[model samples]
Structure formats: structure tokens, C-alpha cells
Target: MTSPATSDSAFTNNSCDTEKIHILDLFAGPGGLDVAAHFLGLESTGIEWDANACETRYSAGLQTIHADVRTMRTERFDELPDNINVLAGGPPCQTFSVAGNGAGRRALTEVKSFIKRLVAREESSETIDEELSALGDPRTALVLEPLRWVMAAIENGKPYKAIILEQVPAVLPVWNVYREVLESGDLPGGVKYRTECRVLHTEEYGVPQTRRRAVLIARLAEHGHASMPDKTHKAFTRPKAETAPTGMATLDEAILKEAEHVERPRANRKEREPWVSMSEALRESSKKLGRSEPYVVVSNYGSGGDPKNRGRRTSDQPAFTVTGKISRNVVETPDGQPLPRFTIPESGILQTFPSNFPWRGRDQAQQVGNAVPPRFGAHLLAAALGLEEGRVAEAIEKMDGWPQISEEERERLRKIGCGDKGKCPTKPPHPQG
Candidate 1:
């Protein structure tokens, strides 16, 4: 595998010095972070192995390298250009997700131990790979791929200036362990990173879903001030019931009726904006599809440990966590009239992708479901790079309506930088809102 030729051109669109910050995204599913990078006028290349997702990336004119991250370890690290000073990725989370088999959660202890050994150089790469192979599912070991690349880059004398990683909430402990090793300067070149890891609520970041992700951000110790981004929106809270009035059919009925009357928590405008709701997000799509009435989403799966008790959320609330099975959820009007489930583009909207983002190939639902919402990614990138809040807001505003570039324009932009430039916008005009 050969690295794409480096370019010194500056992206004149945003405030960041684009010539100095290039990102390499690993396990980059469907170009979520890459979209965020592009909105910020930063150059990025995604390494994804899924053909379906690669097809979507190709259609969207994003830069991509169709390869497994594991193969990029060690000597292959040299194949990456030296201009890549930033590393960002959300590795496969199937094993760690609640919807998954939990193989990664079960192997957390072993994975943590491997992290220590790798940082200390206590074992050969082959030995570690052999042990990792025994961990039931092969994807379980992919979570550690980011750290391996970091170590490899340090040894190659090109340590990334900033590193951003994210996965399911269950991976927080793993990130905690990473925080330790990274800050300890125990790796090959004794590079010390100022790191922070925590579980972030997507709703607080303005995504129209209530997903939680474990995020880790690190910067070279000398870079100064590395921390999680501040919440830009208020968190979503379930509505509570108020006391029933004098005339009521029954306690249950009264509770149900009065719940809507109860005041939900609200954020002071000076503090943060209110959390985005499903209705607001789908409003445009609903209008285009001629759906104006309120609806409820009846989940396909069980809730509260009872298979019969399916979870339900009204259109007014933020959506429940979106999974690959999103298409399986049922949508119905308040009066029990059946409605169409969210379309692929609607699901992408809920995940904070632009409504017009070109989704191609098979398992498009999975690609949308698994993506890191571009709005959320922009916040994380801004915080990690110490950009101003205004810059983050600007990037997110553009995401509200990402334009669909023409095929001819896409071909021209795709040739701007390296042969595999994911989202290198030379002068991405302000997209129409």
C-alpha cells in the first residue's frame, strides 16, 4: 500500500491552518467524521473495508482507502503520509454495543492487558496478534487498532499532534486505560499525551437521537488544553406526570393524560439550546413526504427486560438510540394509523447526516445507523483542535443542509490532493441552508 502524495495547499474556507492539519480516519464507516472534517475545511482520508460503505463514500465523493486497519500496522504505517498530524476514528463497535453479542465487553480484561503490553513493548506484534485472534470474534480486536497505529506512528518519528477516538459507551473503560498509557509516556518514543475520556450524550450535541458514545481526545502535552467539547444543547429528559384533576376515569388514565400537561425541563437560552427532537429533524422530510400529523415510533425490540413491552417514543422527543435495525421500527399516527418507517435519508437525518447525503449500495441503513453524526463530530474536532465555538457553530450550520455536488464537480474535487482525498474541500462554498 502506497501513501497518497502530500500537498501543502491551504484550505481557505475555515479558520484552521489546513496546510498543517491532515486527518487519517481508521475504521471510517461511511465518512461520518470525514464529513465533519470537510465542513471544518480540513483534509481527511478514511480507511474503510466495507464495500457497501465504500460505495457510498465513492458516491458522495469522499476520500477513501479500501483496506482493513490491521494490515496498516507496523511497516505499513510508513505508507501513510507524514502530513497526517491528526488521527481520528470510531472503530467497529458491534462487540461492545448493547445490541451486539458482547464479545468485546467480555474480553475487556484481555484487551486492557494487551494495551499495557503494547505500550511497554513487552511482546512482539505477532505474539499479540495470535492472542487477539483467540478472542472469539475477530472484530473484537479491532478496538485496539487505533492505539497500535499511534504507537507505530510514534516509533516512526511522526507522532500525531492530536488523536480522537470514539466507540460505544462500553468502551469507556478501554479508553480510560488508553488515557493512562498515553499520558504516561511509556510508548516507543516516550511521547506524552494529555488525554481525556468520557461518555458523551449525542442529544446534548444536537443530534436528533439519544445515543451515548465513549470519546477520547488527546493532544501532545505541549499542545496545551485537551478536553471534551462543552454541551451545546440541553439533555433530553422524560416527561413526568402531574397530579390528576377532580374528574378522571382512573389513576392510569389520569396519569397518562396529565403527563403531557407536566412541564419538562428546559434550558436557559443563555446557557444552551434545547435538545433537538425527532419531529423537528424530520419536519422537512415529513413535508416532502406529505406527513404532517404527529407519530410514535414503536421499536422492534423489547424494553425493561420484557419482550412484550416494546419501547415507544413520541415524535416530540429525541429518538431512542439508532441501531442497524432502525428500519425494523414501526411508525404509526397517534390515532393508530400505520405510517411509513423513517426512510434511509430520514434515518441519516436522525443521525445528523445531511438529508441529501448520497447513501449508496447495500445495508445503507447500517451505514447510517453506525455513523458518528457529522454535527457531533464537528464539535469533537473543534474541541480537540482548540478552535473557537463560532467555528464549530459555522460547520454545524453548514451540515444542516449539505449540498449534493454534481458528478463532474465531485470528480474535480476528488483530484485536489492525494489520490485518496476523502473530503478535501479547496474552497467549499457556504452550502445553501
Candidate 2:
């Protein structure tokens, strides 16, 4: 496929303009950040090679270039429009994820070395490419792709005004290296960015899942602060069973003391809301499915890989991290009566995608698992663009449904056999205990 830069029609078709913030999302899987950008009233074009994700993007009417990021040369930026001022992406995180083999984690040292080399211009691109290939898994090298694009943009004399990147928490060290390089003032242009990198809890940002991501935000030094957004919800604490008071303490007295301690923080509680619970987040799903009883989710995998020690959570708590194996999880009433596992829409909802967010193509579970939650992305986008808090709230409200696609666009996607009708199985293929 041709690079989006050469295909000026991509920008023109999307109505990209200089008046508003426009984002170019790299490795933009299935329009997660694009959904947030759309709701926030920003234009974005995502570059992705995965056919599965491209199908979904087309169905959702998201601006997309179905090409690999690695193939898009740095020189392509010379042809890109001036309106695409922001850069945002969440690179593939499999090798770096805690649940996956630790290839990326093991290669962290080598990756950092590569960053230093790139910043100092100590090695040619060909040499660095050979070194990166030597790393065990090819995906491990992708963590540094964003840095390459950033340097390329600067060299092209069109540095982005703001940049946002996120991945599994294990990638924080990589982002720290990015922060160092961006702020080092050694780029082709003397462009400097005020940067911050930190691990953010999704539940702290109102996502109904307890996912943690390492995020980096950088803004041109001429721009104001580039801080992470303030948390808008209280952090989730796992529920613990109550035990009878020991020794001289009576049960009532102990209960009273515990209540007082909890109440003490109430005076300042107005600053943030309670962490969103699974029941509250999935309320609409439950009602639509005609399930009135409370339920518990029994994880498919064990807590830390022990088959006998499966994890369990009630509807009152935020969901455990949603993963590709989400269909393997068992949902049941509190009394142990089996209920259906979450459908595709429900799974997307847990990840903060709209319930009707048109999910299509293969490995739909993986798509949901890999996406940067739209709610979380909105906050990141707002902070990077220096937008006010109200913008985030407004954007979130718009996420209740997917964006409406025009009839002409729908026909265009339909001709390519991509439409709003999602083909992925909603229910699991077979029953599981």
C-alpha cells in the first residue's frame, strides 16, 4: 500500500485542517484512539497493517491507511499536511505484557541503547535495523518505532505540537528513555519538549477495568505544561472479608472504629468519585440481556498461573484486566449457577468502548484486549492538547454510541465487504465450567 503522505486524498477525504488539532496514530489498532479523537472533535488518521483491524476501522468509518508503519519511510512526512500536528499511538505490547513471554522486557537494555544511538546519530538506520532484527521477537523492536517517527517529523521541519504514547506498564522504562531523548535538545531541529512519564491506573480514570498503562505526554517547550491528567475517581481496593474482633475488642466497637476511619477521608471525597464498579458499568448490558440477579465472574486462568487457583470477582468490583482469553472466563450467579460469558459488545464495554462500537473481523477478543480504552485515551488527548476538563466529560458522553456513518460511506465500505454488521461470535463456541 502507498504511504498516506503520497495519497493526499486521505487527508482531503477526512477533511483534515489546521484550525483544529489533528492526530496521526501509529499502530492504531481498530480505532481505539480514533474513537476518542472523533468524540473530542479532532481529526485523526490511523496507520495499521493488520487486515482484521483495518476491517473494523473501515466499518466504523474511521480514517485509516492500511499500511505497515515500518514501510512508511521518514521522507513521507515531507508530503504530509501541516494540519496533522499531534502524534499518538499504543504500539503492540504482547512481548512486554506481564502475561506474555518477556522478550521485550529482556531486550529493554538493547532498546535503550538503540534510542541513545538514534538521538546521537551514532549509527546509520541500516545498522540499527540489523541490530533490531537480531532481537529474538520482532515485536520487541516496535517499542522504539514511535521515537523514529518523532525524530523523522522533527527532521522534516514539521515537529508535532504534542505527542502521546502508551503501552503496558512494563514499557515505562522505555518511555522514560523517550522523555530523556526528547528533552535532550539534540534533534535535527532544536525542538525541545516538556515531558512526563508515569504509570496510570485505568480505574482511577473511570474505566471499569483495573488496567495499568505507562503513558508519556510531551509538549513543545513553547507550549505550557504537559502533565498527566488528574485522577477523577478513587482507586479500587479489593474487597476483604471481615473477621471477628480479637482479644478485648468487641465486634460492634471494631466495626464502629473501622467505619470512622473510612469516614475520615469523606471530608475531601468531593474531589473524586468512587471507582466505577462492574455492575454499574454493565448495567445497560444486564438489563438488555434480561439478567436481574447479581453475578460473579470466575476467571478462566489461575491467579499467577496455578490452574486450581482461579480468580473470582463480584459485580461490585472493577473487572480484572480484560484479556484475549476473555471468552474462556465463566460468568455465574453468586450461587454458582452458570451464566453466559460476556459477549463481544460486553467485552468492549468493559474496555470502555461504546456498547455498539462496531467490532468486526477476526480475533475480536484480541482487538478489544489490545485497544487503548477510549475513556482513558480521551483524558490523555485532552491533557496533551491542553484542553479543559469539561471537554473530556463532554467527549465521554458522546461515547454512549458509535459515530453515525453517511450512507455514501456505508456503501463504500459495503462494496469492500466491510459494514457495521460485526461477524465475530458474540457467545463462546462451547460451554465451559
Q: In order, how many clashes per candidate?
A: 2, 0
Q: In candidate 1, which residue pairs clash?
A: 63-421, 63-422
| Model 1 bad stretches (over 4 Å) | 1-16, 238-270, 408-433
Candidate 1 clashes: the total is 2
Residue pairs with backbone overlap in model 2: none
Alpha-carbon shift of residue 402 in model 2 (angstroms): 1.5
Top of the candidates by lDDT: 1
Runs of candidate 2 with Cα error greater than 4 angstroms are 1-18, 74-80, 239-270, 411-433
For residue 111, model 2's alpha carbon misses the true position, in angstroms, by 1.3
Model 2: per-residue Cα lDDT over 1-433, one tens digit each: 2123223222222122334577999988888899999898888888776678877888898877655576554424543457777899987887877666667777888988898897888779768866775777667777778888888888777788789999877777788889888988987777788788877889999999888788899877666557787789999875432121122124224323322311123233347899998889989988998765588988766653456667788888888888888888899999999998898899899999998888889999988888889999999988787676777899999888897677688557544332243432233211101
lDDT of 1: 0.77
lDDT against the true structure, per candidate, is: 0.77, 0.76
